[model samples]
Target: MAIGVAAGVSVGTVISPYAGAALADDAAGPSYLLVGGTGSSNIGVLRESGGRLIPVGQPVPTDTGTLSITVTPNGRFAYVAHTVSGTLQGFRVGDDGTLERLEGAHLAPGRPIVGAVVSPDGKWLFATVGSVTNDVQTYAIAPSGALTHVDSVTIPGATSGLSIPVVSPDGRFLFAPSFIGATMDSYAIGFDGRLTPTGSQVPTGDRPALPSVTPNGKFLYITNEGTDDVSGYRIAPDGALNPIGRFPTKAIPHGMAITPDGRYLYLPQTGGQSVNGFEIRDDGALVPVPGAEAPSAPGHLPGRVVLSPDAQRLYVIDTLTTTGTAKVFTYRVKPNGGLEATAELPVDTGVTFSDGATGVFASLGPA
Candidate 1:
């Protein structure tokens, strides 16, 4: 399974199906960073390079309350939702990048799943029973990774919380975000991975929370966290959404990280502890990446933000740190997109940052 290899350590080998494209930084292969939240029932795993992030081997339990993590574009497998144990676990990517608990695979959608994603062709694994079941479930990803449910879709006007849907790097379209019901829901990804409501919902600006999509799937961004700003859209070849407006940010913004040729875009701002940056205008407007903002460290709060599938580096995820501990900063992705802090991985003392929680989750395993 060659996913982030480490077991006996000897990366001096060969196994390329693009070898999962080396999970992220691939200086020949070795990439990982998984963290888990609500204080950790164990998931941590680190081990990237250039931008640092070390720790790999130890924390890997999972079964208390993780809230989000879904790596499987061939990085073996990783599921892990668990909104207070509503369950989802599954893991099995141990070349050396550790993590092995996948016994019966786990599953459990009884309620409160909170977030999970995986369809760029790793079969399917969507999941987000969001706040008390606003719906969006679908499973089916067996080839040993387990998980079979396959269908649920009910997000029409869900006025409460939790959101983690985004899946359109050509996997068709999924884009969910309905947190507090500001709206932003578009689907149409079925060939078996059921979910088809390209009815497009739209509206968003007051609490929309998270949803990022670019890398050529056109544009989609949406981080409204109760209106600090960032809503822009334009993915309509059928997957609906066409707004392209509200873009202010730096008050709450939550998480987002795009760049792999889709221009820039970073935004972290858990109540503005900072980490802005943008620049993706072809029509889906959003300018302001000149120096890339970035601020957190004083009181520390930045929620989730990733990039480093060779986009250089730029990972934030500070649910708390300033001593309370749960850090994972790292930057250096400047070719004009700015941001150069570089290095800061602490995590494991009760990871805190809430509201659509997503503590951290990079990939590229196989070294």
Candidate 2:
């Protein structure tokens, strides 16, 4: 049965089939995935339609060891990073938004993996490995969505790290926020897809986590879990980051994302259990937009925030509770950077999953 989008209601399902792709060709209104805690170490896919989030398919298990997952720009495949297992799992997307495990279930590089992301061109995949081994491994995407390790680069002081690696929109630079070091490092992506340290590390507030780039590729934002602030950096031509502003957040900011229109930013403060919205000024500074805070319901721990392809809706994922149930919230995006509740629904994963279920969903839309 097909899930219908109702006003201000969350809906979900667990099945594998190709639902029709009926989004407009506006370059901004594609469906999204809300990857978070699953019953058994897996990720969930939620399709956004008319400001509501409906479960389009079943949760795809990443085996034991995968922690963070990210989809390519085209949304054709997803890369799952297994922090404990030191492997990355690749999954191909079926027409109905369900995931099918690719030929290679595990790409083991013998390093503790923290995050994985596909390059803007979707030709390569990058994984950040830390703890036991502090390095970034590069892999070429095979035609069948499998990964073949190409090269690896060791960061000087990345021995203690947690944040995932992020590539710039231009695909010329890479940013990795190290929680242990409390800094964000930059690297230059060479022509051959190799990474070269840019020798520039920007000091962040404290325990910096995810680092996201702006839509225009002019600014980078980093969320500091320890200091309760978001740091902004201006993107320099030579792949260097210059500080723009460091603004205070409500509490512990975890996940963050810039809107598709490049006008607003959304960050989920886990400590306060609220989502903070900001207006992006031309100078790269962020000002909290009025009426932009969305509080998480009781007993829900919000994990990440992402925007729909059309920039008209936002999705927030909440990891499951003690009883083993997940949730995804949908919001209508206002022109002035405020959010209105559309739907808040619970997702049922057939099994119980743990902390390794942290990941963000993506759609096949514009860069």
Alpha-carbon lDDT, every model: 0.71, 0.71
| Candidate 2: 10-residue stretch with minimal lDDT | 1-10
RMSD of each: 17.2, 7.3
- Where does candidate 2 stray beyond 4 Å? 1-34, 320-323, 343-359, 362-367
* List of clashing residue pairs for candidate 2: 8-342, 18-96, 19-96, 28-309, 28-310, 29-310, 39-351, 39-352, 39-353
Highest lDDT: give the candidate number. 1
Task: Choose the strongest candidate by TM-score.
Answer: 2
Candidate 1: list runs displaced more than 4 Å: 1-3, 6-78, 81-100, 104-123, 126-145, 148-172, 175-187, 194-229, 234-237, 256-271, 274-298, 304-317, 327-367
lDDT tens digits, residues 10-70, model 1? 1112222323433455555566777675555555666666666666645555655666787
> Candidate 1 at 251: error in angstroms?
7.5
lDDT of 1: 0.71
